[model samples]
Target: MSIWICRACGAHSESRSGPPPKCSICDDERQFVPEGGQEWIARETLASTHSNDWTELEPNLISIGVSPAIGIGQRALLVLSSHGNVLWDCVPVLDRKTRDRILELGGIKAICLSHPHFYTGMVEWSEALGGVPILLPQADLVYVTRTSEHIRPWLGDRYEVLPGITLHRLGGHFEGSCVLEWEAGAEQNGALLVGDTIQVVPAKGWVSFMYSFPNLIPLPAREVRRIASRVADIRFDRIYGAWKEKVISSKARESVARSAERYIRRLES
Candidate 1:
């Protein structure tokens, strides 16, 4: 028996003799099953084919993405703080080279995710790096496809993972969708690593919040306002989205506020 991971979204499933009947994540409205239908691959199979590539986004933050693009093809960010290194999101494949490279920099202290779609290989990652704590929002517990002892369900709207790193739940893309705020990032002005919750659009300095990004589904105005209000006061100068180069260089706080208003006005009109 081995843990099976969905090829589409990269969410893991329980260990079994064969692949599960279907991937609930792919079937859900927020995501979609491939036209060819549901497909599954073991962790070992993924490791053999894919490898992680690291890029330094800022002084102490590095973006880790798997080569050939696995799953949603989102790149995970590693924030290096005085407290320790914090992995903000996850990729499907975690191979020996990637593990060694991270260790060479500084071993991960804890792993935090933005939502369920990025929960791929969290258990395996924790185990690979000596069982670090995996802090997942309690609100999204039902979305956890793979169960593990390393997971620490966090309650409430805010959770401080390290000295200067914090997770804030904004509840747009998912009920438990959260963003990581690094106080010392962006040359000390602060940086927000938002995974799909507040997507940094192709247009610079603009962002969009949605319930289903792939499905072109917009979230409710009330939900968008709630998400905006929750992050309205956060002092962040930069915003990083799930994909590579999807970032807002400055005035990210105002950008989010403005984006929310724009999203609401368009929907209400």
Candidate 2:
């Protein structure tokens, strides 16, 4: 058996003979199958050609992404903490060099996900790093195609990964969509790792909420308000989105609030 990855979404599927007929994640309403139809790539092939690139987002936070951009092109954050390091999101490709560098940085204590869209190769990631636990939202468990012993399902609106690292559920993009609030980040002002749950839009100092990004579908006004209200009390100076360079540098809380207001107004209009 081999792990087949969807070319469009970077979601992993286990197949005994060949790649699955179609990627369920891509067939879903939120995502789309490419014009060429669903395509699959073997993990070994991906590892041979692609490699992960690293960038220091802040003092203790590092961003890792696959160079040449495969499978949604999302970057994962390696959050270094005294308690242990936490991988905030996951990418499709994980090679020897990437694993070695992470091992040098104390390995991963836990693998946390924002939603199912970025659940690519999570089981692989956990197994590679000492079988660390993969924390996923229970509500979105249906979207998980691949399974492993290390996968842990979490419920409710709030979860504490560590003493100061918290996961807050703000259900807009997905029923169990969550964000990581690192209290020690942003030079102690705090940082929120939101994987398109509240997207940092192209507009400067602003963010947006959506039910479907590629399909251009919008979330309900109430849902947007609920998402805004969920993070209203959290203290965060910086907000990191899934893609590289997608961030609200500062005043992120205020930006989210006003952005929510704007989204609501436009929907009502």
Candidate 3:
């Protein structure tokens, strides 16, 4: 038996003789199965062809992504702090080189995911790093496909995973969709490691909230407002999106407010 990973969404499944009949995560309304149909890959297969690529986005933040674009093509952000390193999101492929590099820069102390879409190979990652605790929102616990002892389900609107790094649930994409507020990031101006909960649009200094990004489904106006309101008081100067180069470097707090107002206005119109 081998741990199978969904090719479409990168979610891991239990050890099995072969690929599961279907992928629940991709079959859901928010995600979709490709026209080519559902597919699965073994952990060893992924390691053979793909490799982890690391880039330093800032002094204490590192962007880790997979080459050849495994799964949903999302990159994980490694936030370094005096307390410990926290992996904001996760990728499907983890190889020996990547594991060694992470160890050199101080092994991960905790792993917190923004949502289920990025839950790819999280258990494997935690095991590789000597059983780091995986902090997931309690509301989204149902989405976890592969169970592990390292998984820690947290409740409520906010959780301080570390001393200065906090996870704030905004609830746009999923019930437990959250963002990491690095209080000491962006040169003390603060930074937000936001996944798809609040999407950074192509236009600079702008973001959008959605229920389904790939399906083009818009979130309710009230829900969008609520998400914005949740982070209204959090002072953050930078906003990092799920993909590479999608960032609001400065005035990110204002960007969220402005974007929310714009989204609401368009809805009312």
Candidate 4:
């Protein structure tokens, strides 16, 4: 038995025998499978060939990602909170160096994901990191290929993982798609760690929402408005997207509102 990782989207599957025939994550419309067909790599091989690079985005926030870019190539965040550290999103590689470095940074108390696409190697991550609880949204439970006892699924619109860090489900990319609100980030102005649920586009000071990012499918006007309305009351001065250097440094809340309005106007036009 081995854990097979999808080469395309980086989602993990635990097989009692061998690699699964297909990766459901890559097959979905939100993601896509390569023309060469599905490819799977064992966890051990992944660890041996690839490594993680860590960067301190701010005082208590760290960005972790795999080198050589496996899967969707999104970076995970380590949020150091007052109560405990929370890993906001996850990647495919978790080796000795990655584990040791994280341990030196006070360790992680919990793991919260933005959605299913970033759910790569989570079960192994939990087991290796002191069996910490994986706070997963109940709405996207069906996307979980690897099951573990450490997963604590939650329902509703929000969940507070620490003193000032919370997870808010805004539901754009996926039904359970969400973002992390860290009150202590951005020098106490608050920060939102949004995966592609609310994309930090190449345009500075703006962000966008999508139903299928890779497929170029746009979310309807009503859904975009609802996502904007859901985050209207949150106090955040910065927004962090999945990839590196993808941030709205100031006036992020205002940026989101303005961006949404612009997106809707373009759609209506």
Candidate 5:
């Protein structure tokens, strides 16, 4: 069956023919089914049903719409070079308009997700774009539902999918959590797109670590140090986060280093 959105929690799934507004995870979350009642959108329905407004935030980055009032809270960094063009993270919906827009920019070289939740419609995205591969760190493979021959796996700290783009596994939030490092990264005005593996504190334009569990768990100070070290080796002066408010300018790399080190020092002190 084609994919559909759960009316209750907005989860996208191909599990049609089940009970109305069916979603076990949302049920467990204690989020009730929608009062408007159950509704479904087929995979093909996106062509007409969903319209993505892609706004270019930088040279090779765009924030695709995640909601009328919010973007995916994840930014997609497009890598363009003699090697190829790639989208660093995946988002939930992809209609023909978006697909065509992305294709016009040299098509997608590959699709990579920083972690499980960000997997979004990656497989569907790949399929719609003529089977562009989905590169996921093997450590987070269990979270992927849409597996394809086009889905590639990276088993270690870093993988180079394209010439200028690299994915670095920082391992704080999720064991396989990552950030994209463009060869010409933020400094080139291209931006380093971090999808909350290290998050921005909008109040101060700094980065911090998070433990994998969402129940307010905190990442250990040493783990934060390690993440900082991993990211430090890469060169990116600018940084852009998923949504509009979570971004910082060309000095983000320096800020991230200082913030991470400050966090580590505080814990040791």
Candidate 6:
């Protein structure tokens, strides 16, 4: 038995067999446990609530897409690589169609998350991908509701999901926040798959560049510089933020540098 997030109530439940037994507090109208009755989601059962529609986002660097949770607030990115495919972040939803699509794109090799909030369907996803390794930052392991042999707790400033793909933790939103630097994003340099760690404000045209997109709170100039410094070491030509327009097509490094300086100047001034 593992902890599963209730789609309706958003509460973590120690799921053992046959749907969540009416989500303790909320009732059926609120959530539906998986049919197997033995379906397990996370290692911790106390965790609750989840969203469906693990809606797959678009893929390009290697035929990947963002798995979306309609009402819930979270995002998952799918990355297809020859060595093995990886799903970055994670939405609350997961279904057969998406599974079929994942199979078509090549079964997932691993799922690396940026933080705990995005760890929604982690266990379910890991199981769906034939026990694909779910790489988590050791620091955030406390939030893991579902414990699995498949869950590989790793520590450090960065993690290698697969060949040409690396997960770099540049603390921001969460202590273990990370961004993916994919060598395969393109042949030239690479692409940074940043969930919301460094948001792309499509509405602003410029990358929103924030500590927290949800809160609209800005990071200190020092923090901004740190993020920029961490990312600067990596060779990337583009930055993929979490939306349609959250990408910077201009000189990638230069763009980050400018954004960093601008943030610092504004904060200081």
For model 2, residues 150-180, the per-residue Cα lDDT tens digits are 9899989999998889999898889989999
lDDT of 6: 0.65
* Candidate 5 TM-score over all chains jointly: 0.83
Cα lDDT over the full model 2: 0.92
Off by over 4 Å in 4: none
Give the poorly placed runs of model 6, Cα more than 4 Å off: 1-69, 72-74, 203-205, 209-211
**Candidate 3 off by > 4 Å:** none
Against the unseen true structure, what C-alpha lDDT does each candidate score? 0.90, 0.92, 0.92, 0.92, 0.69, 0.65
Can you write out model 3's per-residue Cα lDDT over 17-105, one digit (the tens) per residue? 68888988999999999999999988788888899899999899999999999789999999989888999999998888889988998
- TM-score for model 2? 0.99
Which window of 10 residues has the lowest lDDT sum in candidate 2?
A: 224-233
Clashes of each: 0, 0, 0, 0, 3, 23
| Model 6 agreement with the true structure over 1-269: per-residue lDDT tens digits | 55555553233455557455444423322233345442334434322332234333334443223333332344566777678788887755566667777888788888887656566667777787688888888887766655678988788998877878999988776677888888867454687788777766544434535554444677777888888889789988777665445677646667777767877888899
Q: Give the per-residue lDDT digits (tens) of candidate 4, residues 1-269.
A: 68999999989999898899999998888889899999999988988899999899999888999998999999999998668899989998888888988888778999999999999988888988889899999999999988999999999999988889999999988999999999989999999999888999887898999999889999999999999999997888999999997899989999999999999999999
Worst 10 residues of 5 by lDDT: 24-33
Q: How does candidate 3 score on lDDT?
A: 0.92
Residue 213 lDDT in candidate 4: 88
Give Cα distance to truth, residue 108, candidate 5, Å.
0.6
